[model samples]
Target: MSISNTTNFTNPSDFILLGIPGLETAHVWISIPFCAMYAIALLGNSAILFIVKKEPSLHEPMYYFLCMLAVTDLVLSTSVVPKALSIFWFNSRQIDFSACLTQMFFLHCFSVVEYGIFVAMAFDRYVAICHPLRHSTVLTNLVVAKIGLAVMLRSGVLVLPCVLLAQQWPYCRTNVIPHSYCEHMAVVNLACADTRASSYYGLSLIILVTAMDMVLIAVSYTQILRVIYSLPTKDARLKTFETCGSHIAVILIFYIPALFSFFTHRFGRNVPLHIHILMANVNLLVPPMLNPIIYGVRTRQIRDRLLRLITHRDT
Candidate 1:
């Protein structure tokens, strides 16, 4: 075959995922835990939704924000894990260009939405603690609905250009993506054409959306702490901290690994490629798996409802 003909086979219409480097012999073994995590995430988030729906008391702004978070986690997890499972169990790693782009879009869209939701939740906590009297007036259902809608729209609009630009580019190079699922930059780097615009856009999107949201969340918590410290008693301080425990756990779970993975990809050139890929997958998986658990355990309302749910179901 000619060199051009040889290149054609490597540049397939569908891309194959490198499930995990240095562990090809153990893909099935690796898949078991991932499968469990995905199952738990799905069930746990669904239960959160169900409990929030069935319990009329949970119809308030806090649960409303949580419901949004649960939905975002569900979408985000579903977008990636199924494909990863396929790659692991069935060795079916070929993903069409359109399918890959679709996955990338949802993965990023929900990710951004979830970040926005975190900021929304931070604001919810802020109002609940700092301005308790006006919390109801400020975060009416209409307002929460508007916030939810705005977050979703903002994520969708911001991520669309990345997809459009990617679609316009011709992938003349090898189509093997070095991660188990379609990630934004991994796929972007595969394009043989000039990708400076896409690179800049992705970086800017991360900064504008995720980084900005993190800063806002931090500021919200700072104000919340100030309010808590101003309270007269140690009991008051403890109560305030207790109220924020679940959100704090979730914020740490969601951001720490994500930011680490982001920085690794950008600056950790000495880091192993597999480490980068593993952390990326972990960042996606850990939050969904842990969020429901954290909320169920730490948030009294959710824990009480969950216990009541289990007891009633058993009876």
Candidate 2:
């Protein structure tokens, strides 16, 4: 909570990103795992995109939404990690105000979009499982495309006000952001102006968006479970559950870390600053790194296609 003099508030040109301040000495070592995760995320998600595009059998709504998720994970990681690694490996810690705002915008936008995709996927599963006869008509390719576009536009529109709000503030305080990335609230806290509106807006959206999506997902799954139990055999029940395993795993990975990080940042009085910073970074990193692996392992089509693709390349 370092505050600077108000006299320096004359529209500062750039802000300094204090990347993991407590671990500055070990930043290079830290960059090793971070870079590795980024690389794996990039490669893994790319493989998903490629396989889904090449396989005509995967031209369904579920895989299309999965492809959207992969793209989001790719962009989300790219938004946060390169700059973080730069701070770690090259000591490139300074970012222009505009650049920081842009980073924050994309970081939050893609994140919102990612959650939207999860909701879309959950809806896809609900339709597929609970209404198998009408699933095709209900979630046609055109409908899926529209849903994907809507998710993108919805997130883009919602997250814009956040960055625009940041732009209005005068950064008279120490331009040093305590976290690795330029999150909206972190940047807002540096402003000399009243930030009640921005703070309220950000928190309200998080609660609203996350709660709405979680509630819808819960309803979808509840209906799905009711449908599953009506099946005549245990094998049929297990098979039905297997189809949802990847989505469940991904939802847990995505929401649990994100919600925990959000809570700790906003309310964890006893939590250390470094822990907050680390969770912020973790929320950004882990899902992208693990999502493709989860899908590849749990979803038979993706696993088979990936293995065949690799085997063909090897041969």
- Best by TM-score, which number? 2
* lDDT tens per residue, model 1, 91-181: 8878887899999999989988988999999999999999999999999999999999999999999999998888788777777788898
The number of clashing residue pairs in each candidate reads 0, 0
lDDT per model vs. reference: 0.88, 0.90
Which stretches in model 2 have alpha-carbon errors above 4 Å?
Answer: 1-7
Best by lDDT: 2
Worst 10 residues of 2 by lDDT: 1-10
